[model samples]
Target: MENVSVLEERKDFILYKQNGCSGNGMRCDANSVSGAVSQRACVYCGARVVLNPITDAFHIVHGPIGCASYTWDIRGSLSSGEDLYRNSFSTDLRESDIIFGGEKRLTAAIEEIATKHQPKLIFVYATCIVGVIGDDVDAVCKTMSKKYQIRVIPVKSPGFSGNKSVGYKMACNAIMELIKSEKPAKRKGVNILGDFNLAGEMWIIKDYLKRIGISVISGFTGDSNYENLLESPAATLNVVQCAGSSTYLANRMEEEMGIPFIKVSFFGIEDTTSSLIRIAEALQDEEARQKAIAFTKEETSKITPLVERYKKNLTGKKAAIYVGGGFKAISLIRQFDFLGVETVVVGTQTGKKEDYDIIESLVSKDTVILDDANPAELEKFMKEKQADILVGGVKERPLAYKLGIAFCDHNHERKHPLSGFDGMINFVKEINGSINNPVWKYMEESL
Candidate 1:
């Protein structure tokens, strides 16, 4: 509220100073303002991104072809074995089908996918059109599940009903429903939640935990299959990496299956070490704790010297962060700090009050914090703060380049890992390369 010059209607959503605020630091967890050109994706998109990482599941969009095409292979979530999730299936509902109800089209699509692919699981996503047409998506799924003796789940996500956060909830609910009927033998390992395994990041975390004598029973969706998910309730604990999308599922599992969960982030050196220690402590395994301590000590010694070199080169540079979740934004701030980079602007599409509070505490007094920011707001604040670089997803890439600022891919589109110790090295390398590129000299001269 420190008199930041954003649009009048968006004043409540942007904050320059937290101490002077009477209530919460920034307004968040609300629908994007009308005509704000908010960067948040639709409800169906949110659900699809969260659930589309299941490697073996057949995902069918029960709407027009556009909806399916818009999010085809949306996440960079990689699979080790099956890659059937890479294919985007649609009912291809036409105007005639919309008038007569697209339930038949949806059923036919499911039947074709099941028969040809022989998939064990199928997810039918209800888009805005399906929601409007009153298609009985759930009933169709139930009938198909009975007929094929496979799990045909219905994900209720209408783009017009709510924002992306609501779609995340819908995805979690579908996951819960998927695992409800199973009763697998309990495993002594843990379930890793919220990570979509972009660039095999989940695999890196799994390796770290394995080195510390911890077993990962399954990932929430990333690189996970139907069989693995059926065993989720059997895990001893749920370790959440992306809290925005997976916290609700973890809460439900804890409430019903007595499986406790701990939120952990593995984005930077500090957070990776801390998360390893926390996970070891949560499991109450003495051997694992000692191994984790030794491994972190050795890894830090090897990585710190390399990181210090980058810190020297990146000193005094400032970065603006706009990401899908608060957890990632907070991690990026810490990561930039590791490289001696100042974070001048930060925001998220689905961050809660607690996430924003942590972010506010971490940033400098002059840092601009906003929620569900539009491109105009982002550009204004980035220029005002004089950010040298911007770390965001695909949507923000053009904006950063248009401003002649360096841009780093930190979201689903990236093919590189940025989650563990190795990922930290890759992240700094990319940041250094982009920021120090000689092309900026020409850009500056032209400007």
Candidate 2:
């Protein structure tokens, strides 16, 4: 690791080799720099990631067409029932509307869509210009809710207000408004949080919970509908998977409804086994706990041989991770460990200080830990670390290729589910395919 001078403008944004270089923890959860080409998305992107999986909600972007178009069905969250959430609706505000007021058009768009679709819930997202023009999105949503007698939620996600983490809090606030259960019936169930059910990952986890005699009352938004979200208060506990997006929601639920929450990850065999046992023990169900232990033994026996085969081929490989949140990055480090891979360089877009603390504690002393890293910083760190593979989202794939490094897609666009027993297998297969490719041999010699 090398010490690089930070620009006066970006002094608070970039950190230099914080893994073992400094006693102070890395700074995180701040607004991205103006011209840094940061991989972090806008506030609206954060809102959409958490709320767009409502299977039957009419998600209308209350701004220009670009915002709606860019986020239309962006996630791979599948629906078990209605596919209404897949469609992107926009008010399509133009230059004239921006100069004037777009509230009237927004109201009309809501009325038109509600009449045609007859959806039970609607989510209106405000964009950058909507924030600039000071549109009364909340007032319009209130009026529309009264007019249609359906829940019309307003997500105040102005692009420049803060980072994506701000948008996640805003989305949680909107959901709190929709909860109508005052005295929910107590049941032996749990609410799944943070997972967006990408490629049916939530379904896989739900099935496992069912086998352990626990019912899943609702998912945060993944494959979840309006009715399921309304029933969330009835559950006894909350099992949070993606802590970055759902921790706020879980904390609010505990405060408002008196339901406790526990953070868990099902990304690797070690995590998945522990999470199942933890969930069962939290409920004090002796039968469920025994079943969970039995389930882990069976599943591990089936998956370990496949993982061991891949581990033999992938021993001592070094990996670099750059993802949206800290939980995924932490899980990836463990997932890589199963295959004998070392995470040399790791960074996150909106990871909190606590997440960075755990990340710093887990990796080797020489590994690089950074926050809100730009493309130039990522390139420099990966090359300096001599990373064999880069595990990141779509944006970093091209950069890895240009450097003759292997790349893996661990973001929302990936069709394969990377969760539970099935996900562990997928994780190893993806790493083996990327790092052990035949073309790398030729490229190495040519370089």
Candidate 3:
């Protein structure tokens, strides 16, 4: 609407700047436009993010070294046990392999890693070139599985195939292969899906659930090892935190294993309280429900006073969001609301129609909602909205700084935990620190 100099094809990718524009809903979940510089990561990135948290798995990038190098230890998923998932393995495919086939080289790489590590599980990710060169990654994985008597999962995540959401589904499919359990759920248990234990956030949630008489069968991947994943089918229900990545896995588990799922978020006080209650209600555990209510009250009481202090300085601040998924954007909107910050522009790399619908309903009428946004689009919307702060991943941080806007790290690589009551306090601290920093005054004076 605002004659932004975006490619004609990308015009539909941006909205809500025109006169009387509501920005309620716009197109989303489509592949990134060619040469648009979209913030969306590759399909392999999606797969890697979802599966890379398995603490004992040997993750192999079946392509060039760049893919593995860039994604190596990309997430701050802390492990309580095995730290094997931290290493990045790759075939380092060259022009020669692209011309012929990298299957042989892939076999050799798997063999090499298997011989040394003797890992029980290995996830082999197919990159863009592997898809182009027609490497049978599944066959290679299958052969290696038999040879080593391990689970060699093939993640068919060609970067060019689709956007990050496609990669999430790809990762979920691969994880589904490893979930094989015939025994019924023995304990009052649930599988935590999509919370990748970033900064031990998963551990925090697990502790709260334990106090409420629930046992965590396993996290979808965060701190979850091969054995934990194999036992995931035994859980009675699945609690999905990051819906964009783990929804498919939850649905599949429900259908195949008869394990029902409930979407939950632990990002803020409101979501955390409600999510705990939802889990208890789903399990029909009155004692757990009571404990969850008591815990919510106790936790909120301790943090509310501190959070209000930060809110006093942060109130009326406008923010922009460009994150990986829709659920996080939705949670941030509510979290910001709790802090009295208005989200003027929000977008996701791979949010679905339903996600956008919920996001539109949550924001103000004139707020912009975009899908698969490029840096230019983010800059234009953030500037147009006069936003004071931007919450995004590493890639978007520099852009926010160059624009003289405050930034917060809400992505995979963030070391600080941003979940539960403690996370709400952290969130407030981050906002207050960024928005009230003294450097901005100098920046404004110089500008």
Candidate 4:
């Protein structure tokens, strides 16, 4: 048999050539090449992805309308409190506002919003334009905080200054500020970090915890509000999911509040079960562990048939993956196996070395892995590798479709919950649906 490798010609990517194409460093990081449409989003996007799930707080985008328009309610964070945060409140800075200064308009917007909504908190997100215009968002927020007698925090999330990781830091700073305002409450409950209740995934996991007799203090951003967040220190433990977005916050919380956190994943069957068990064990309670066992058994049994059926149809298919975090890339390698699919090419925007190691261990010897991959690299790899489908976010979706390949929505914008036992079934259904589409036949013919 021939060595069927998919090495391409003339691309700036280094991941595939060095360090064995595992979703980690050696391929890319914060360094951006001139004029490249890198698959990674801006810093504001990163911060927005992390914080937009707070649900109740008034989140105002302090920039031109585009930033607000692009990120309006983009995450799957479910709202259990006031839905005011979901509203897109952009300063809509026009050319004139940019020149004279946006401080006055921003002040009016804040006062108007405060008078109308009387929200518990208001978060002003600075965008690329705001950073450029030098708007004094902090000063304005401070003044408004006094006038409204509410917490008004300013998030510095400029798009071009750095990549999304910087935004994560900005969001964490805002969250930390929110934590500082209230007294810490000690309780049996724990904080679930990075589990935005997208499609109610947080709600689903919360239910499982409740079934195991565990109380939840709050989620990091998903379905979270100001009051619950301040009480995060009261929780006994923190379960960190989506570590790329929440680990910094968790570490900060641990350092400041004497709370410990554990890394967890709730995507695939294996990850979800393991996460439940890990959380139970972290609490160090016998009753919780036993209840977790029973809960896991029941959910596993219920999901087996669905996984099996999807496995039958999706087995032996080839997939190209592009995602945001290393944890997801790692979990997805396992998820693909459950459906009998092989990941030929996999990559992420911000996967660490440890994550790459896990991805390398999961895949076949010749699989392609990449970090901070651009559209050009992805297109080159997918086409050359003969992958049938691609799994990625909105930016990559259109590119994948343009090349006549199938895609899955694994990003924050997805409407459905892809967590828990039911999520396992939905995962199967989504994968199977894409793999079995009749459009592939047409694509093959055109190719």
**What shift in Å separates residue 251 of candidate 4 from its native position after superposition?**
0.6
Give TM per candidate.
Answer: 0.98, 0.97, 0.96, 0.93
Q: What is the C-alpha lDDT of each candidate?
A: 0.92, 0.89, 0.89, 0.83
Question: Which candidate tops TM-score?
Answer: 1
Number of the top-ranking candidate, with lDDT as the measure: 1
- What would you estimate as the lDDT of candidate 1? 0.92
Lowest summed lDDT window (length 10), candidate 2:
12-21
Clashing pairs in 3: none
* TM-score preference between candidates 1 and 3, better one: 1
Clashing pairs in 2: none
Regions more than 4 Å wrong, model 4: 1-13, 17-28
Can you write out model 3's per-residue Cα lDDT over 119-138, one digit (the tens) per residue? 89889999999989899998
Candidate 1 stretches greater than 4 Å from native: 1-5, 18-23
Ranking by lDDT: 1, 2, 3, 4
Give the TM-score ranking, best first: 1, 2, 3, 4
**lDDT tens per residue, model 4, 394-432:** 889998888888888988879888888878888788888
Tell me which of candidates 1 and 2 scores higher on TM-score: 1
The residue-by-residue lDDT of candidate 1 on 105-215, one tens digit each, is 888898898888788989999999988889999999999999999999999999999999999999999999989767888978999999999999999999999999999
State, as a TM-score between 0 and 1, how close model 2 is to the true structure. Answer: 0.97
